[model samples]
Target: MSARDWQKSSFSGEGNACLYVSAPDNATIRLRESDEPDTILTTNPTALNALIRNAKAGRLDHLSKG
Candidate 1:
C-alpha cells in the first residue's frame, strides 16, 4: 500500500508513536508502528477485530503479571 493508504489510529497521542493500518483487500489487513513503518504485520479481518477488542478490554496489557 502507499503512504495515503495507511490510516493512523485516533487513540494515538499527539506527536507520539502511533499504530497504523491498511487493508487493500478484504482477505487481509496490515499493521505497522509509526516508529517502524518498515515492519508490517499481516492478519485477517476476524483475528484483527478480536485483537482490537481484547486490547481495548486490557486483555493484552499485562501478560507477564500472571
Candidate 2:
C-alpha cells in the first residue's frame, strides 16, 4: 500500500508536525511522522495492541508531559 493513503491520528492539527498510521497489513503496522516520512517505524500487531490498550487505560498519558 502506498503511504499516501495513510491516515493521520485525530490528534494531529494544522501544523505539519504529526504522526501518521496506516492500517495493519500482513501482521505489521506502519508509522511515520508527517514531517519525516522517510523514517518509518514498523511494529508487530501484539505490541501495537498493547500500546493501544495502555493508551486507552491512561498508562501512556505521560506522552503529554507538561
Best-matching candidate per lDDT = 1
**What lDDT would candidate 1 get against the real structure?**
0.89
Q: Pick the candidate with the highest TM-score.
A: 1
CA lDDT of each candidate?
Answer: 0.89, 0.86
Q: Write the per-residue lDDT of candidate 1 for residues 1-66, one digit (tens) a residue.
A: 689999998878766489998999999899999889999999999998898899989998898577
Candidate 2: misplaced stretches above 4 Å?
Answer: 1-3, 24-26, 55-66
- The TM-score between candidate 1 and the true structure equals 0.78
TM-score of 2: 0.67
lDDT of 2 by residue, 10-53 (tens): 99997888989886676878899988888889998899989989
User: How far off is model 1, as Cα RMSD?
Assistant: 2.1
